[model samples]
Target: MILIINCGSSSLKYQLYTPDLAQVVASGMIAKIGEPEGYIDHFVGHRGEHHRCPVPNHRAAFALMMEYLQSPEYHVIECPRAITAIGHRAVHGGSVFFGSVLVDDAVMKALHECASYAPLHNPCNIIGIEEAQRMFPGTPNVVVFDTAFHQTIPARAHMYALPYELTQEHGIRRYGFHGTSCRYVSQRAADLLNRPIESLSMVVCHLGNGVTMDAVKGGQSIDTSIGFGTFGGVPMGTRAGDFDPAIIFHLVKDRGMSLEEVEEICYKKSGLLGLSGLSNDMREVSEAAAKGNARCQLAVDVFVYHIRKTIGAYAAAMGGLDALVFTAGIGENSAEIRAKVCEGLGFLGVEIDPRANEIARKGHPNISAISARAATLVVPTDEEKMIAIDTVQLTMAQPGAASVQMGHAPSTHGVAAS
Candidate 1:
């Protein structure tokens, strides 16, 4: 099995996958670390259990989780050593790693250097890697970056309209997030459309709590929405997506708010929660909008308007759109939101069939009319499977791989998911 780990500043999320990368062995998440009592939810096959765990840090959480992995009652692996490889979901690989790589002394150093780009995410990821290496000893470990997929975005699209020297010196350019999900969905979209991914022009809308629109050309990312940080692009759960530098200055000078305070506003107090004067959850906002709540309606309106504007702009940028994809939380569940965004896009040959969209949930495919020129699809992302595929391929390419393969059964082995 190749274990997949995605750690945040205070949470560690993990999945244990059979080496074939086709089926999950187990999955769980631990949250509120560094406290006397945290929470851990573990699932093996179809059964799961939740517990209030006193997880002190990533290391403590790892130790506790390893116990469960070794337990007979719900064990996925007979022993911890049964895990041949560990794949870490590292954010901000910067320009150093274009693809997933085996973690080593040099690679660990590079991950640290890129930490400033994603301070909130990378530190926890690094901690997890260190702990896993110590706990798993000689098992092969790899890092798959969230920023790595967007590395295909060319200079003109990623460059900022600032002094060239300052930009080069500071590495201040667009480095989009949700790349893992974006990459997976674009490939899935191609499959649904029955076309070569390399022969298609498509746009992927990853509209979760954190939203980003990526324009993929010829199976590569040509452009994406989130820039430099997750703090920009389309409005999200709590982030102020698009911001002006002058607004920060004004908030500091006129409102007497500190830069840090302003940053908090940009990060936590804005978006749907701030605009609607309600919760950040889209379901809540949608419910209030249905009840004729004006601010709630405006919040939904702003979101739909951004999607429409982004789709139109990306189509122009990519020459034309052959397919449009919607994935993640809001995109997958909200048929109402999808209809509103696809409206008036008939100019782009996007004709949404209301009935089809309404019944489209739980991983439904096309939601557009059969006569529509552009194909519209809703694909659930499988990031862990992608990570497992990359891990197996990279590890198998190394020396002694045959011996490594012989150590595990066929069920523990996986086909490389390229």
Candidate 2:
């Protein structure tokens, strides 16, 4: 089995998949880690077990996860050795790692150096990798980066307008986020359209709590919405996107506010939450808007406006649009948001069938109108599966990896199991 681990700041989600990637054998989540009371929800087949206990850290979380996976009540695996390989979802690889690679001493050191790029995330991801290494002993682990798919972004689009020397020295460039989700959805869109991915130009809108608008042309990311940071794209649940740097100057220099205070406001106290003064969830904002709340209406308008504008800009960048794909929470479930985003996009040969858009969540992938020139699709992204595919490919291609294919541990040349 292949184990996929996604470690967030305060949560760890995992899925156990077969080597063939055909089915998920087990899955669970350890939430609110490092808190006074943490929650564990584990599922094997259709049976689920939940617990609320004191979880101090990621190591403790990993211990509990293994315990639950092997418990008699839900024995998904006989032992740790049952897991043939492990795949990790790493948020930021920076420029150090352009693709998923086996973890080694040098990779660990590079991950430490790249921690500053994603302070809250990379440390936790590193911890998960460490715990897996220690617990699963000789199992090979592969890391799939969220930023790796965007490494193809050209210099013209990724470079900022700052001084060339200073920017180069500081490693300041657009390293897009949500690459994993975009990659999965874009390729899924091509499959749904029955076309070759290398011949199609599409824009993938990953609209979740963290949003990303990526222009994928000829199976490569030409440009993306997120830049140097995760909050540079379209407005997200709590993130202020594409704001003027002058606002920071005004708050810090003129109003005498600390940079930390301004940063908090930009990252935590802004976006739909700040604008609506209600909640960060789009469902709540849309509910309020329907009830005639002016601020909620404004919030919805701003969010949709930014999405529409970015779609237009990406279409221009790709020269033409063959498909527009939407995925993630908001993109997949909210029909109202999808309609509003497509309302002003008719000029780009984009149109959605109203009934199809409404029922998209019911497994209708394509919502494009019969008369539309470009296809609009709602693809449910499976990032864990994507990571698993990469893990299987890379691990099997390593030297002396035939042992792994036969459900045995890998050799030293393929992975350092010691």
Question: In order, how many clashes per candidate?
Answer: 3, 0
| Candidate 2 TM-score, true structure as reference | 0.95
Worst 10 residues of 1 by lDDT: 409-418
TM-score of 1: 0.94
All candidates' lDDT scores? 0.84, 0.88
Give the Å error, residue 162, model 2: 0.3
Off by over 4 Å in 1: 398-418
Worst 10 residues of 2 by lDDT: 406-415
Error of 2 at 356 (Å): 0.4
Residues 188-274 of candidate 1: C-alpha lDDT, one tens digit per residue: 899888999998899899998899899999999888999988879889989988878899999999999999999899989888988
**Model 2 C-alpha lDDT per residue in residues 67-176, reported as the tens digit of each score:** 99888877688999999999999998876777787877777887888899998799989988999999998898888889889877877787777876544466678889
Error of 2 at 342 (Å): 0.3
**Candidate 2, clashing residue pairs?**
none
Best-matching candidate per lDDT: 2
